[model samples]
Target: MTKKHVHSVTVSTLSDPLPSVAAKTKKTHSVWREYVKSRYLFVMLLPVIIWYAIFAYGPIYGIQLAFKEFHILDGINGSPWVGMENFKYLFFQSPDFWLVMKNTVLLSLYHIVFGFPAPIILAILFNEIRYDLFKRIAQALTYLPHFLSWVVLSGIMFIILSPTTGVVNYVMAAFGLEPIYFLGDQNYFRFTLVISAIWKEIGWGTIIYLAALVSIDTQLYEAAIMDGANRWKQTLHITLPCLLPTIAIMFIFRVGGILDAGFDQVLNLYTPGVFSVGDIIDTFVYRMGISQMQFSLTTAMGLFKNVIAFALVLLTNYLVKRSGQEGLI
Candidate 1:
């Protein structure tokens, strides 16, 4: 009887592993079957995959150039490594480092303070609008500027802000005031940048919140109304609470880009006079890497910016999560 019991225990031990093995095999089969069935979806995504592979992941090979003294004759592979010299030069050696960092952070902070709320306010207003036709027209107009390239926008702005023959100057003349050089004046330039950025992207940004607003349960608003709540009360209590998760996620993303003041906008609009207020990490990198051919320095700067951006994103996500909100980690 003891021998029979031992044999049964042995049988049970062997059979336990059999079910696990079968389960793993079944999971693998299911995964492969799904992949086969959705091959067309993957086919549709081929261009995006190929684009990122070539343009994004493919460039990862050159990242080592940041640590090396790259020469045209020596080439990337033949370049001699300098370790952290390039990074040290970029951060400590360059006199423009602190000034450029200040400009970048200030502009980004301005955008966060003013530009971030513009879209939310616009979205809220649009949601409250009773006139569908006016809402559609206003949305279309706001969205138009975003499609225009910064180069084109800069030209339009130059014409509009011209001290001599601009409509803005004409308005100032009518008001018996001096015609201000909006683009060239250091005092007004940053304000122009912030306002233009807000105007350009406000509509596109609103689309997200508008979608969020749509997803809100109408029954909640109905109950609020039944309980003597006005539109303001309903929006404050119900709409805002429901939108918090989306707002938290978007805010985290914005915080991640705190160092990326609008590169294209500043590049097109800025001159030597405005460089103090306008030059940012991206523009700095462009001048160093493209114009001066300081490959290692520019690459190091790029890496530094990315590292800070990543760290900010992680920190912001952690904070948001701790506040019991969904974060875009």
Candidate 2:
């Protein structure tokens, strides 16, 4: 070929993409087509996407306030950066910080110890129930409290747990015992919080475990029975093994939020008398940020809490996987 012709051929060859590039372009086109085909599903998901973008991810921008000396006149962007001063104050200077941390950790541990297994046991008991009517009624009764907001529930609790005129005290009186201040006394407040939390959430928590239970193969239980396994033995082997993955995932989530010790419940239920035991990080943050207007300080507190929570989630996930279980990675 002539020099110009050869040059033209070389130019054409150079202009065309290589095989890998062409394959990637083709894959992109295929994905675009799939997305177009699923446009209706995308439309259905748009609101949820918007909600997370707005409420969840959007607020992440304000996390910088944790490091700033935030002023009301000066917005978050206008605030002067403090370079971890707020965190220093939180760790060293704040007197209530350690107290609240202790309370939060203890309450969380209590929930994990007492509250976490409650739903699983309840769900297993529910599975054992042959009477559909009774099961449904029990479930409905347990679930009713979950539907009520903490404000309303606190009112109900106040009436139910009142020292003098309450039904509990009345029952105690029948046995010639002194009326107890469950809500007001610091000693009893934590116990009251744990019990009420369990009572409120146990049924709602069971829904997931119950759903997982449904997905377990009935034949496994039958096989266990054929092998001379009684009801308890069947649960021990068949039911529990089937429930392990779900339990691991749920436990990871629970541990991730170990710092969140029920703000609304504590806020509504606790008085100054029980502040030593019942106060938690959330409540402390609320008082600092909203009630007292220590926005920067509270922002730092929140950032600290979220960092610890994130670390806990990662650690828990790692441990779960190490234990040969499915985890929420």
Candidate 3:
């Protein structure tokens, strides 16, 4: 080829890619420009990001303490590794292990059996109510308990359940029955915990079911009515079927948290007398780690709870999916 022709070919080769290259460059610039335009939105999100970074994720480093024989003097970094010693201690060596585990599991089961369904019933009743004003008042009354912290709620419980001048006791006395110390008695403590938990959380839980109810097609109810179905039949055939997915998702989450068993509520309400029936894994961990200073052992307990919770979540989700419903996996 002639030199001029060769130069012309080189020029064409360089120019040929310019359109595509320039398009890519412009696309990249547009992305950054869009990001810059929406920077204030990100700035608004910065606090949440930082909050999670600090509170939620920052403590992840301490997970290593579960495997290490943590020492106050040696610190987390210098602590000697102990493999599964902490876990072995938690499972076999600790005196409170089985007791606390049983309490945790039983309490969770109680809550699932009674507490889980309480809100569903309440939501249904609320939905069935014809008077909007009465419904609103009832909803507000129920929702009020959820806003109270467990500490405050527990204090109120102590006052109400006290054997001396409590309103419950007063009613019992008027009925010619003995005043009972509900919180102090082991027989009553677990039941009280479950009941209180239901009372506190049922309102909040009802909110979710109410939202799900709103999404149900009104025509389904109309169709059920046209088919000569009663309220009960409609609930069974239409309302429940429509709500199955939401209920399944919530049930999965509830099962995942079985190990939790209301740490704050149990801690605040329970005394040494009720420890046999009321002391759960979280409370046991608190006593061991905070009160008694068994850092590694308590960390192991927490780690164990987390692992079981994670596994339960996965298993429940799998079962839900197998049942032909949407799951939270």
Candidate 4:
């Protein structure tokens, strides 16, 4: 009987590792089968998936240039590895790095504060306006800026804000004030970019919020009024609350694109004088990568921007989750 008991214990010990190994195999098989079952959907996504593979994922293999001395003929794989030499140069020796970073971050923050809320406010205001014709006209005028290429707008801006005889300067001269150099002044050029960006985009930006607002239940407003809630009260309690998710989503997207300060705007509007303030990472990349042939250095900067953007997206997603809003994650 004692021998039989020992033999049963030995059997139990022998089977212990098999359960875990079998469970792992089962899980892997199930996952693979599930993925195979979704093959039809993946086939439908083939074009976009292939496009991204070629355009997006394929380019990622070159990011090692940041750590190597890049060469055209050598390509990425054949390039001699230099470690963090490029990054060190950018941080310690590059004269423009700090100032450019400062300008980019400050301009981005300014846009977040003013540019982020402009559309939502405009949408809410437009929604509140009772007249139809005025609303349509206002919408058209605001939307027109978005369609106009920044090149045309920049030309118009240059004409209007030209220190020499531009219309805005003319008006200032007529009012007996000094002609302020709006575009040329490094101090004000970033601000000008942010304002112009809002002018061009506010209408289009509001469209999403407007759509969200339209989806709000009419009965809520009716019930609020029946409960003696005034227009302001109803807006505060019902309208604003209904719009929070949309706002949060918009905010997250804006945060994700913080480094993207409109390349066309900068290219068209900037001159040598304002390069101190306007030479952002994108513009810098264009100049260095395409113009100056420092492909590796510019690629490094671009990689840095994307990394920061990726982190910001994650951080914003985290904050959204904490706030109990629907999150990208």
Per-candidate TM-scores read 0.94, 0.91, 0.91, 0.83
Between candidates 1 and 2, name the one with more favorable TM-score: 1
lDDT of each: 0.92, 0.95, 0.93, 0.89
- Backbone clash pairs for candidate 2 read none
Residue 86 CA displacement from its true place in model 4, Å? 1.7
| lDDT of candidate 1 over 282-301, digit per residue (tens) | 89989988999999998888
- Model 3 / residue 299 / CA error / Å: 0.7
Per-residue lDDT of candidate 3, residues 135-251 (tens digit): 999999999999999989988999999999899999999999998999999888989999999989888889999999999999999988999999999999998899899999999
lDDT of 4 by residue, 1-329 (tens): 69999999999999999999999999999999998999999899999989999999998888888888988898888989988788888889888777777777877888899999899989999999889999999999989999999989999999899989799889999999999889999788988899999999999998999999999999999999899999889889999999999888878988998888778988999999998888877788788888899977887788788999999999998999899999887
Cα RMSD, each candidate: 1.8, 4.1, 3.8, 5.7
lDDT, model 3: 0.93
Colliding pairs, model 3? none
The predicted structure with the larger TM-score, 1 or 4, is: 1
Q: How well does candidate 2 match the true structure in TM-score terms?
A: 0.91
Error (Å) of candidate 2 at residue 41 is 2.1
The top-ranked prediction according to TM-score is 1
